[model samples]
Target: MSHDDGYGNDSGRTGDGYSTLGGTRQTRTRLPDGEGGDGYGPRRPPRSSRSLVTVVGVIVLLLAAIAFANLGGGDGDKGGTSGGSGGSKAGAAPTAATGTKPVTGKNGEIAAGFSQDQQGAQSAAANYSVALGSAEMFDKTKRDEILGNVIAPSAVGGFRKTLDQAYSATLFKNLGLNEDGTTPTGFTFISRTTPIGTKVTKSSDEQATVEVWCTGLIGLAGEGSTKPVTDGWFTITMELQWINGDWKAVTHSQKDGPAPVGSDTRASSADEIAGAVNGFGGFTYAR
Candidate 1:
């Protein structure tokens, strides 16, 4: 609503996203005399008119106050809850912290013994995504160990057979690593997955399906390297089952991303990238 400033002019927005005052003519209001005037004679608006103006002013102020409250209170009402379901609107993704502590136990280097809830399934999916995408998985021994730990017992053999074929010598060579999956001396092979977020698509006491959105660093980081460290976005979906008192992946698969556009930031040098990967530690994700 635009305001009239007693000159038949409306004061508010113009169509071009800017504010402007628009008027075609002046408007004059004549009123009865003396006391109710502007402390001068014959210029005062009538008492009834003055009351109506006061009421309108109060109503505008009240409406503005309500609008302001609504704008500020929307998110405050939904934050601090878990399960990726808290925000300004229904079904919105959560952006606030869940306030739940990360899992403390470890099965070797892998996170283990996740809580048997929706959050636990999401956490397990995230950690498994990291483990499966790690450089360790390029090595046959470590790869088998990781599968054993994260995969359900009934699915372990199938996973091992599938991964063995997937991580072939050609893949290692293409990634600038030795056929045996070791870093050719003086180069650091990076295959780390950092989970950006997680969502539980289906959940029950016995089984749950989770999708972990992740950003990954891969390739070799070193001076004069054939394959420089590059990043990619992808999502890994894992079907988890409550097996042997913990959540384990029954089936897991990857798909190419809900990717964001690349930024214009300059790429770091090989040594800087390698140094960063060495210096920084990885985190265990929680819901």
Candidate 2:
């Protein structure tokens, strides 16, 4: 709100934002008249009618200030909605921390106790989640590459054997792909998981539980396809331990949801969703 400051106006400013002033503003202080104290002064005369206008002006200004304050505050209210069914993709990212640090001493403490270096441990965790939740995990050849690259040398044999049987022939065929895991005719199979956030659930010198909350796009998204794109959310918790100067995944598990209700708009064609996903990139999380 603009203020007269009893003379000149404030420059380079207008009503910038709203603030709630119901409790924030102070009532105008009138000059004290001749009273029990300060006895030498004569009685003051009645003030001018302009005082009424000034009082009204101050009230409007205070309300405007309140509105400005609310805008700066992060609230449950947002400008747009996704057809009022789910949150808009354009909604500003809601923050959990008001003034919190991304990393405190927990991760540092765990790393310090480990025989391995800290950089190696964090890098290992980041890359391991990428590999485990990638689209390439659907194909045996890519799966082998991922296991070789991300999993520890000692754990590779068991990891590959377990996952090899887990992603079976029938499962691949059901994913709108060829028996060898190629995209079928008139179909574009999509299986991508993007991490939204990561946290150290529990950390120690030898072991830690890093939980990765993720969102994934699954099913085929293409023309003439029976499998339409579907979105799901899950939190995958990986147990990590220090070995060979690096953190390696000991085991991990997933639990579904925090899912929003489906929307009422016309469902976009598989091609559209596929095109959007292909064009837009997933974010690299900070906290």
Candidate 3:
């Protein structure tokens, strides 16, 4: 994966990769010699369109897992539950749902008003990571709205300025989008973040810092797309401060992953990936 560090520096790692929120990679999927050319060239053979209904079914199940993963309880606990009917050991991180309810307020489309405790800080950090990693952040207007909502008031201006430059027309073209950040006529642009779990490394009545482990999917999911949907793991550290009854981010940064080995599951087609992204909805996370 390749990424720009938002400061004009570019870097990348080989093997399976995902782009950082503000950075992007340019890649292409090649077709057989006799088949059509890449999206950059001629038209390609049309793929069968998968049913959005089937995609929704798969999405529902995946979201069930996502909900459980975010509800992982206990301070600083990683992965799943410590121990339960799934036979995980006393301190083992197992993926099990304890039925913990999610947070219940919104500042516009983003979750807001997290608690002042460690759990609250963790939840806030996780949700903010999602907002920061979303495809909507590519749009200038939406980017400003997201930063204003999630960042600390004292620091929002700096974030806005830095990100405005980071998400430049050049970056947009690298990601296969128009200069203004709109998807081309027939492609589905995907940029989403799912938190695996969060750990609070430091805490206080007025401030806390949390690290959110995450897996993100990015690229253009559609027939003839140069960039196909790909996944990668990363961790984001957010320094949060308690201000005006909510947890607001003072600063955040991302690094490569504690990624697991790749699985043997078959890769889905472009239509399926597009259908799934369009059919599923994101969540409001909680600890």
Best by TM-score: 3
Worst-scoring 10-residue span by lDDT in model 2: 4-13
Q: For each candidate, how many residue pairs have backbone atoms clashing (under 3 Å)?
A: 1, 11, 1
TM-score of every prediction relative to native = 0.67, 0.54, 0.70
Residue 64 in model 2: lDDT: 21
The residue-by-residue lDDT of candidate 1 on 184-214, one tens digit each, is 9998876677888877665545666666777
- Tens digits of lDDT, candidate 2, 28-123: 211111100111112212222123223222321322221110001001212222122221222333324323222222221121122232222333
What's the lDDT for all of these models? 0.50, 0.38, 0.55
Off by over 4 Å in 2: 1-127, 263-266, 282-287
Candidate 3 overall lDDT versus native? 0.55
In Å, residue 67's CA in model 1 sits off its true spot by: 51
Off by over 4 Å in 3: 1-3, 7-101
Candidate 1 deviant stretches above 4 angstroms: 1-95
